[model samples]
Target: MKLLRRRGAVSLDDRLAALEEAADLADGRLEAAAVAGARAVVSRAGARRSLSVDHTVAALAGATGSGKSSLFNLLSGTALATVGVTRPTTSTAQAALWEGAGSGPLLDWLEIPNRHEVDGTAGGGPEGAEGMAGLVLLDLPDHDSIELAHRLEVDRLARLVDLLVWVLDPQKYADAAVHDRYLAPLARHRDVTVVVLNQIDRLSPEAAERCLADLRRLLDADGLTGVPVLGVSARTGAGVAELRALLESRVADRRSWADRLAADAGAAADLLARASAGAGAGDSGDRAGAPRAAEPVKAPETSADALAGPLTSALSQAAGVPLVVAAVAKAHRHRSVAATGWPVTRWIRRFRPDPLRRLRLGAASAPEGDAVGRTSIPAATTVQRSQTDTAVRDAAAAASAGLPEPWAAAVRHAARSRADELEDGLDRAVATTSLGASRRPVWWRVAGAAQWLVLAATAAGALWLLGLFAMDYLRLPEPPVPTAGEAPWPTVLLLGGVLTGIVLALLSRAVAWLGGRRRARKAARALRASVEQVARALVLEPVTEELSRHRRFTEAVSEARDEVRPGRG
Candidate 1:
């Protein structure tokens, strides 16, 4: 029954502000039907507040022949509403203002053209308006009237009035139409509702008490257990003074308007909470699934982290990071062979293509004058695309696991907001990554230099031997040669030079192979880092922002729910 029973130190403005914030935050994240009541409350409260807090508008409503109009005349001390000549006598609402002159604009807003000025003397009420100065009492048309428009009039005024007096006859007080259609729904408005048993003068005291008891039972079943119920006879003036006193007190307090409005806001806020909170609560539960006003809801698993892992994997394949890493390794080995190969065959290695350059992953692969551009990596295929979409939707589902359908849908949309840019972004990331393949290792250069020097020595030794042969054959002088032991210097140089070059080349090849693999692993790591950045921009960040909104929305709803609710007794 806390349908907006606002109780606490919170001011009216603060409560309304919290409600407004919730409604605004809920716009796209909650269903329209769920938040519609909230919007209406805000509007109605604003209008009612701007007009008057000094006045109280109370409505006397009941089925035809219940003497509701007679009671209205008895309390207000005027015959503003017609009394019992025919059924459906009051076709429209009639207002009786205790502070008559100043309430025209308010009555106009209420659309009650037939307003009477009550001097408080006509019905044996207090002699002046001082007893109920700011009361605007309405005698609404008969709710049970066969005339459709008369019934419609009663229903219309019922919602607008600050206080409700459900006048019932002894015979029909327990009727289902009255109990089911009006009292049951207004159970939450108990503090501002009153039930009067009219025509009780016909019953003896014992009979009247019994009727009152039976009526209370009916009201309790209608969920209006604590609502005020009294016996009054408009024809005999029995208990009319008591009814007048009740009305006067409510008007003097001048809180019924605010209380009524607060009740509305609470009901609307309750609905909003349920809609935002996920579904699955049953009938005895809040049908829309109530959101708790407790501590903020936490992510069991962070959505961004959850989304990034699979997205990064998908993007890596899409961007050709694997291809680039492979090229880095092959290119490193290719360069390695050139750097450490036999001098005679080193030139042959140049004819083979540089794997990194062919894939455009190397600096040399950057076009002669263009930007580090798109890679030669294949586009993401249908299979990869499907996997990526699945990952995003799954992440959304997890992030919004317990949320209502509307909020979950919002999270999904946020996840996919930038999905279309994934492929291009990942490709750019791959292209600009420094795979470290183009740069040569320091050892390669040193080994290459050593190979050339040995080749030079080998040529010199061959030339020295040729010179001796020529000298012996054509009468030329021979130069002296040095040796380590018995071997001539020329022979030693030739054998040592050829042998050293081959051995050095073999040793360098081993080092270069290990270095190439290491560099390839390093390149793979770098490319992955780039892919992660792309995944974050294209996928994870949007999810994070969506979650942020969700947190704020929940917090706002909680504030409305937990803070001092205004408008309760």
Candidate 2:
């Protein structure tokens, strides 16, 4: 109980729910048999819970000549089952219900047609029959009978019973067939099981004690340490009273079926855990198998953060981010030359194509929010495609490292599920990114306006000189030709304006070059960011989701298999 409270009071139903969830999440990633067994546990528990909540079903199971039928008749106070000593007696299961109320459905669920109803004061029965009003005792065929049908009947009923009373004789208590085929496989059901050394009257007291001690040793080795063991003689009515008290106590608890179902679910969950972490796929989950070194199943060491850097870098190269960045720098310079160059020489740079526009990734290509634009960037080359595949595979392998084979395969598959979309996604990301070239700088405008002013001054001075020449030729006096020192005003204006415009154009070009380099770096950062998004959506996210599923599945399995240690008997 302390363990239960410490673990947050996880009930048996919660454990079953956890196991069912794990089974759902790991349908194909776990062993087929193991998964099927878990489903069976859940289905059987639901059926049992719905059938008869008030009754406890305990089946008497033993090998041939173990006097199983005699004991069944003795406890039931009637010759309901035929008894035989040297041969098999009960070839089919027989049930004896107390009062027989609302038990038809329960019997039908157990598939038992031969049944009897016993009253509290009917015959010379075991005492306290009134207290066992909810008990349902079953007599099963010999598990070691020569007839295959009889053995099969015993095996089937044994699994469905709420409690099992295993009847062993002093002669064959250590029988290999019974121990290997039954007790060993049912080690997890210790809480819902009891052992009876039948036919003890035939042996001396010392011999019976020795056999009992030996049987306990065997039971403990089979992982049934806390289960009760009793020595009884049906013919002499030796320990039958004690067995009856056990039945009354179990029925009084009114939760034997619940305990049995919990054990079943726990066993099934353990099977799945072993299947997931076995030495190999399809390894046997049998508890009685030879001992081997235990293996701990740990979570994978890799995560998305560890894989994203290399993956995004490789994908960026594949998406042509470097080429696009270079084009952005050149396109900036080209546009800047037209906007800031001297008015007289601006046309010289017009013939060169805008690098960004040629790739359909210019500032004009990027659209408004949430809209993707098309691009004419060349398709990936063979080398680029190969590099992308290698990087993606490496990422998948690293993400799934240390997982079981099926889970690892699942992670790898998820990593590449979006491979067909990577090309288009990367292109859309590149074309839609804001690549720092949509508007010209304020400096470019100021330089261009200044250049135009200087050019206008130069043009006016030329016209003034032409007029002075014309006036002299026509014998008219020139209008007050002003001079600055040794040079005339028009001559000085013409030389200074032309030289100033040339110098301003050179200065503007130099500034644009430096600005273009800076813009290239910024554009590179933006383009890589876009490509990184593509990488996550296409590959990294899927891998991370799959790993999360694996973790959930394993955690559920652990919880489902965590049985309470104190009351396990």
The model with the greatest lDDT is 2
- Listed in order, each prediction's TM-score against the native is 0.84, 0.90
Root-mean-square deviation (CA) per prediction:
4.8, 3.7
Per-residue lDDT, model 1, residue 87, is 82
Model 1 — which ten-residue stretch has the worst lDDT?
280-289
lDDT of 2 by residue, 360-461 (tens): 876655345657666888788999999999999999999888887778888899999999999999999898888978877999879888988898899889
Q: What is the lDDT of every predicted structure here? A: 0.77, 0.83
Residue-pair clashes per candidate: 4, 0
Pairs that collide in candidate 2 are: none
Candidate 1 Cα deviation (angstroms), residue 21: 2.1
